[model samples]
Target: MALYNAAALIPSGLLSVVFSLASIFNALNARVFFGEKIAVRVVLAGLLGVSGLILLLWDSLTVSFDPDTVRGIGWALLGTMIFSWGNIASRRNSATRTAPIIANAWGMGIGAGVLLVLALATRQPLVVPTDPTYLAALLYLAVFASVIGFTTYLMLVSQIGSAQAGYATVVFPVVALVISTFFEGYAWTATAVIGIALTLLGDAVMFGRFGRKRAGKILKLT
Candidate 1:
């Protein structure tokens, strides 16, 4: 819904930043609902990750007070918060011993059903794409992007808690750029390099890989 509403109204960079805020939301939600301690590293790493995103997107970034832009930002952020909450819900379900694969399957199925109902309500025609290229892209997204991505992410949440797993959301943009550089011929810039460094540093801090002892001191699990 966020992308549907805002993709044309705002820069892709802005949308990515908004969506990447799942880390902070997940940490807060976990702290409230599960009594998980709010590790300082979680917040600090999130800040670093957001800074990296800004730099990475600096060339194409935009700022405006226009109503359309503001509305788009709002929608994107609202959707991201909802997604963050969903992540915590999945974690809770995992805690109750539900398998991540099964949980993910049900979630996707139910979401698709809801979308189908909404399309019918809006009188939108549901037409299957026949183009081979489109079909191939859809298959890649369904298998590699959705099924594998969500299953592994939910497993991470179950293992390390949602606060930590949430940073995976922040790190994904950098991963995408890396993949694009190989397959899509993306060019790198000095600014983007520094941004990637910061993002990696943030991940290290979040995962206790920065300086094993120091990160352990800073990132306490509660």
Candidate 2:
């Protein structure tokens, strides 16, 4: 997923920096917070993942950044930290807490409230589309991505385990690329194609079939 829109999301120099740091933090947290042992193979997997990300980001090196880009990067980092902490907390606390459904309900409520406050404080309009096409898009987002996706993912985590459930995110980039190709006529440079291929292939090696096998090894006992 990071490979798909990463061209637009990050400036090239910052891609490896952000990814490496975030992943290091997450890996460290897995050891410290979750008491999960990091194996040699896992470390190799991480290296491969980073290599793939670098390949994916090779094109964005020439782009320059503005204030908006800086601000977006800051927000992205903040969100990454929050999400990392949340994942650790969820794994540690899930056994004693309510199911993911209840947790998500509370999370969504809090998230909406936070967004509302931020909008008000920033004096920004909570823009709603007047067009029927946008209205339909909103409805689809609300019903599918916001609701069904959330609930179903939680259920999948409970049943299949979080590792397998998390892999679904890897597919979104392909979806986004397809959409971009059709709507925006996204031209694929050779480098860009290689990046996508590396991203997908590395992601598969890290989290697709091999990931499922690894997860199964642990989950079988559960």
Candidate 3:
């Protein structure tokens, strides 16, 4: 939340870079701190993901930072660190006794409880519905984003390995931009178009096409 609020002041490009770098650094920490060996494919995927993010936000990369952006950067870094730790822990938990469904339900329930408690304590409005649009937004977030996306992603992690499954998130901005263009009437700049191309290319690199014999060979090497 803090990081997102900070993002309002910071350039989106810088925020993306900061988050990407944090995740990469956390992956490195997985190797050093947790003693999980880093695969070459994972490293290459990280590079491609960050590069794509850079290309995606190339036009906004020049914005000067303010105090809020600085704070936002700190939050972004910390949030990612926490997130990485959670990922590692969740993976470990899955490897142990618990099923992924139970783990996810517990985690989400606890998180929601914490947020609700905080909101109530601070007198924040839990539901300030001015229109039916708010209900539709809630339904979309609950049904599509939270329920479906998380469920599928966790399943993907178990099947493909977390590092590979993680690459799916790198395409979120591409989806967002496409939606914005169609629904919000966003103008497409040449840079934006190029960014989308790069993002898709990066995804292809991260998730090598099934028919690519060379990529299959590389996976075998890994």
> In candidate 1, how many Å is residue 155 off?
1.0
Candidate with top TM-score is: 1
Per-candidate Cα lDDT values, in order, are: 0.84, 0.57, 0.68
Candidate 2 local lDDT, 95-127, one digit each (tens)? 666577676777788878987997799899887
Please provide, for model 3 over 1-222, each residue's C-alpha lDDT reduced to its tens digit, 9 standing for 90 to 100: 645665876777676666665435545766866687665555666676777777777777876577766777787777666656656666676678566777778878998899899899999987677788988998998888877767666666666655666565566666777798899997877777776776666566656653244455777876
Compared with the true structure, model 3 gives a TM-score of: 0.77
Stretch of 10 with least lDDT, candidate 3: 206-215
- lDDT value, residue 159 of candidate 2: 59
Model 3 CA lDDT for position 82? 64
Spell out the clash pairs found in candidate 3: none
Give RMSD to native, each candidate: 2.7, 6.2, 3.9
Please estimate how well model 1 matches the true structure, expressed as its whole-model Cα lDDT. 0.84
Q: For every model shown, what is its TM-score relative to the native structure?
A: 0.90, 0.66, 0.77
Q: For model 3, what is the C-alpha lDDT against the true structure?
A: 0.68
Candidate 2 has which clashing residue pairs, if any?
Answer: none
Rank order (by TM-score, best first): 1, 3, 2
lDDT of 3 at 185: 95
Stretches off by above 4 angstroms in model 1 are 209-222
Whose lDDT is higher: candidate 1's or candidate 2's?
A: 1
How far residue 21's Cα lies from its native spot in candidate 1, in Å, is 1.4
